[model samples]
Target: MLKPNTLALTVVLALLTALGPLSTDMYLPALPAIAQDLTASAAQTQLTLSLFLFGFAAGQFFYGPISDRVGRKPVLLFGLALFTLASLGCTLAPNIESLIAARFLQALGASGPIVIGRAIVRDLYEGARAGKELSRMASIMGVVPAIAPVLGGLIAPWGGWRMNFVAALLFGAGLATVVALRLPESLARKSAQTLSFLSILRSFRSLLGHRGYRVYVMLSLLAYGGLFAFISGSSFVLQTVYGLGPMAFALSFSFVVVGYIGGTFLAQRLVGPHGLDGTIRIGVACLALGGSLMVVLVASGVASFLAVVGPMALYCMGVGLTMPQAMASALMPFPDRAGTASSLLGICQMSFAAILGIVLGQNLDGSALPLPLTIAATGLMALAVFGLTGRARRG
Candidate 1:
């Protein structure tokens, strides 16, 4: 057996964490195809993504507390089952509306693994060690984004867009099987009493009351805002505006993913030397710098592919560095309530990203101006928040 606290365990946890991107990123290459085949408007097509993020955000409130009362493994398994079934629903969806509904369902299931995985990390590690572990896991999970879009792009031509969902179905089912056999329950101390609505509220309220938690959560939320703007808008911008095909678009996406992977790698090393808050400050600087450059480049009528993707890669690197440290720092003080804390952090992050993405989608002109503008605005705001909040307890 791959014992807990081993690299094997981290890999498994990373896979569990990967359920989110595998579902969303894998389908991105097929988006234009899905829109055409389903005869949906751009906004309607984008709803599939936005609604999934909303469902992902909303579902975490349930999973986090329940996993605290119950254990991680069972909740995760149940979620995987639902995710598998929902993937099938997406594969068989006849219209855009149906696909949108299925995506929401899929997201609800996907939420369980992500929140539980973060809680699991908190269960086993703390402080800088926890940040390192999260960075390692993120580095591993980064592969999914790099690969999923390319794989989906390859699959799109052969079996069309439905095939992308087929891959998601297989992945969910396979992951569920792995969890059932190999993954051990990570929650060391489960709440003895069942969770009441009032108790859940109290848990959330307590997390919200903490100044450090609020700062870290806002940091994460704003970082994600910039990232999701790229995610929600990039496919259309690259494929439609730039006139790239599926494979080419996927390649460009992977290039940006490379930067994120690099950031995660750097974060693992930097956390020990820089401390969590220090590392976060470094990352936020990158976020602001890269995002501003993108805005400048795009606004100056330099809409070359490099102009967009180049700056994006740098912004993504900042995301990679910022997210793990923020998450670990936020959860460090709440070891017992890691599940709930993780859920609240996720709820704020995803909900804000979903809203920002929808707004960006609605404003998408034929130019790439909106994407960089959104990125720069959010990135600068994240920097401002981190600066104003001052240094959090260095992990």
Candidate 2:
């Protein structure tokens, strides 16, 4: 029996959180079109995507502490404004270089809502309850990735890629209006901390020094690396290696989303009873199982699309399970510094994923070996780190 206001707030926060994935996935169908229209190489057009991630990671480091000092509402509104302007810039870019720059700026603007959105959640809840709320939000946010590409595919042909940016612009503006009108300030007590560079550095150092926080953050980074590997390589793997058309590839990608939705639902149900740590263990087990199965399938010469999609879907479910718990756990000890904590978490996840995306992109051959293998390796690393850290803490 959730309150109506609570439910509405969660929905709004979920939408805010979904913006990054929507911005990334929505224009994927237009990559080749963007390249051809701008007279750019495939790699150059791809930079538009990677740079957005880098900007996102970099922007979070700034927004988190600022929000902690100034409150969430102002920061969110500012971000939405920046995001809208950047979206327009993206829509009107004259060339690939301009588009890349606009995309980076767009991500910088988008980072505000994402980092602050999580901080808002931390402001309202804690411990296993926070994990449940996050899982619920994840359930709603999961649909964005599932549908963004399909919408992009439909829209890209109508106006040649720029239409996707227009859609994003409208979305940002609408969301901004919603926030300005209805969203209440969740940061009831703004930190008295200064926004000085040295102060920010000290806060970051303190959080990083916490062994539990470090372990959870590292686990999240590894999980995100695996997820981004899927994102960076999936289009090429499906379209080039498996011969899926644009629409077909988008549909296959939805399998991962479906798995995510299911996993979030499971996490929401289980976290209250099992606790966050137990839920995380279940998630890591799922991740390892899925990743291992995918590697074995690909290694044994089974090249069917279902073979790849099925196991990846399982892996995504694991991601869905792991992230909410990990995020809640990571920020639980930093109630006063939730904004900064959320920011660091976003930076670690996005930076690692961006680096992994570059690595995967560079190593692409005509085979699917690299993607699944990378995913499996990341899963194993996360599990190993989590286990070792837990044992050390107990010892």
Candidate 3:
């Protein structure tokens, strides 16, 4: 849309976006191996990821405002440098505790790009156009995690699991160099807002107080959490319950992402005509339907790996379909406060994801029960929130 060159810019942003999902998914295949190497329990090992997300969420508090104050480019370079170093540290960690610490720092640093990139986009595009551009960026990024586990499975065994960290470091540094050269400052110094801790708190309060933003964040948490629950529990469920090998499990998981892509393709075509509101209602309805089916399947005797995942895939498709409209509508009124607004959205998303993952992990039955129930429950909660919020906004 802006121009054909906009597509090129989206391509770069897509790679920048890849950093977040890449770090999360790439290491998953090696989780069991790392536990064996470090002599840690599954939950303790999971603590690494949890801490990374916590740090990622925490870092957003600082990074968003800093970029808003100074500019997008410098803050990004500084964050990328820190992220690169942290990734290297993760590779050389001597134990699980240290590994967890490095991951926290890594996530802390990664938060800069995630927060700033969105702000940068808000800097460049707005209104409905933002959603289309975001979808374009997401399409490039969305494909990475689909194959990352398979790639990690091959690389970890051949090069030892640490290679994942090393490769990530290299990728980060390369991204940093590209940013240093090509990325112009989108948010001018004059455009930058002075943010105190209290000011940031107020910004967050305002975002939460906004009905549309709150609903969108809730939508993300519930929908994205479903995927992450599957992510966190999949290895255990597939490998432990169904006895699928890591390579096999990774490929199977990759198959689910197709539904996500399909949904996005459909959503993009629908937005210009039906608009955000129509698209989101349709998406939530589909998600609720899929989630209800999953609940019934689990309640009856049909809960197996396929039974659980097949319907959950439909909900994921709804996520891809709805997220653009939901997010765009949320950020629409907060042009000046986009950074703080975006951070709250990220925090809500990750916190919900963390809770869902923990629930699935703690309730591990060496069966698919925990996974499907978790999925259905999250979907149901999201549906309730979506319905209530939709009515509230209309009123």
Q: Residue 84's C-alpha lDDT in candidate 2?
A: 94
List lDDT for all candidates, in order. 0.91, 0.87, 0.77
Give per-residue CA lDDT, model 1, range 281-348, as digits (tens).
88999899989999898888875788889999999999999999999989999988889999999999
Model 3 ranges off by over 4 Å: 1-5, 188-193, 298-304
The global Cα lDDT (0 to 1) of model 3 is 0.77
- Which residue ranges in model 1 land beyond 4 Å of their true spot? 391-395
Candidate achieving the largest TM-score: 1
- When summed lDDT is taken over every stretch of 10 residues in candidate 2, the lowest stretch is 1-10
* Alpha carbon deviation, residue 327, candidate 1 (Å): 0.2
TM-score of every model versus the real structure: 0.98, 0.96, 0.93
Better of 2 and 3 by lDDT: 2
What RMSD, rounded to one decimal, does every model reach?
1.2, 1.9, 2.3
Backbone clash total for model 3 is: 0
lDDT of 2 at 47: 78
lDDT of 2: 0.87
